[model samples]
Target: MSGLGDLVARLLGRSRAPVVVEDPPPTAEQIADAVRDVEARIEGRVPAAVTARVHRITGTVEDMVPRLDRFGVGDRQAYTVVATATSYLPEAVEGYLRLPRDFADRRVVSRGKTSLMLLCDQLDLLAVTLEKISDAVYRADAQALVAHGQFLADTFGQSSLDHPGPGAP
Candidate 1:
């Protein structure tokens, strides 16, 4: 049993630990191009409502790159913060769109919708976070961050407690 557990742990750990490749930080030109590409991709693939939502969230993210300096992200730690905050929304949206409709399995349909709803909620939250950060930087007030954080916490209140039950999904 111990040997089996150790082997399983190593397998899971190895799969999770991706090899690190230190790429250069994105330039203004590269980021602008990337944003354009994402917008174009969204326009072609998703419905108008989803396209609007993606644009709303990603527009704020693009705005953040320039204002990161305005927001005091100009130090050595700037790279880490910027890179960490960069959106991975395009991939998530593409994945969701690609997920097959599975009406046959009633459970799968609900589970799938639950996941999709979470993705949209997450993007909305990301937009709010970026907005709060920009506002905090503009005012040079740490309290704004605290207030937004409180709001986020309140908004997320016991997420598991509110999981879309069956038909609700």
Candidate 2:
């Protein structure tokens, strides 16, 4: 059948295949909801240092959500990174949090805590990386802006461990 004939048939009766549409990227609120939920779940249970890291991580995500639009990603790469970080980290944290603190299986609790610690570290890096990416965006095409690493350190007051160290070549 011709294109016009197919259209007419679909309009009148219907087509067999379903139509698909692209899902809109998550909004800042949706991202904030998951991040904050994880924060609430883990409150006061972890060591003070770990708690501080979680606080910093969640704060960075909160900051990144609104400023995502200003990122120079141009492609969907930026959104994908932010969405994956926010979604995966929170779910993993929630899983760890959901485990009973006094569970009989010491081995299971140990493993869960270990995994949560690792996930929290990864989440920290992810948030810092997003901020660095966004920082680069603001620095783009601007003469006075310093390099990304510098910008990140200046804004966040510290660089990720993965970044070049102060004394490193």
Specify the highest-lDDT model's number.
2
User: What lDDT would candidate 1 get against the real structure?
Assistant: 0.59
TM-score (C-alpha, index-matched) for candidate 2: 0.58
- lDDT tens digits by residue: candidate 2, 1-169: 6788878878987765577888776767888887777778778765565577677767767766776776565556466446654676666566656666444213343446555455556667766776676566556735345575577777888548667979989
How far residue 37's Cα lies from its native spot in candidate 1, in Å, is: 1.5
Best by TM-score: 2
Cα TM-score per model: 0.52, 0.58
lDDT of 1 by residue, 39-99 (tens): 7766665556566777776676576667555434345333432542344665656566666
For model 2, the superposed segments whose C-alpha errors exceed 4 Å read 1-13, 21-23, 71-77, 102-113, 141-169
| RMSD to native, candidate 1 | 20.1
| TM-score attained by model 1 | 0.52
Instruction: Please give the RMSD to the true structure for each candidate, in Å.
Output: 20.1, 12.9
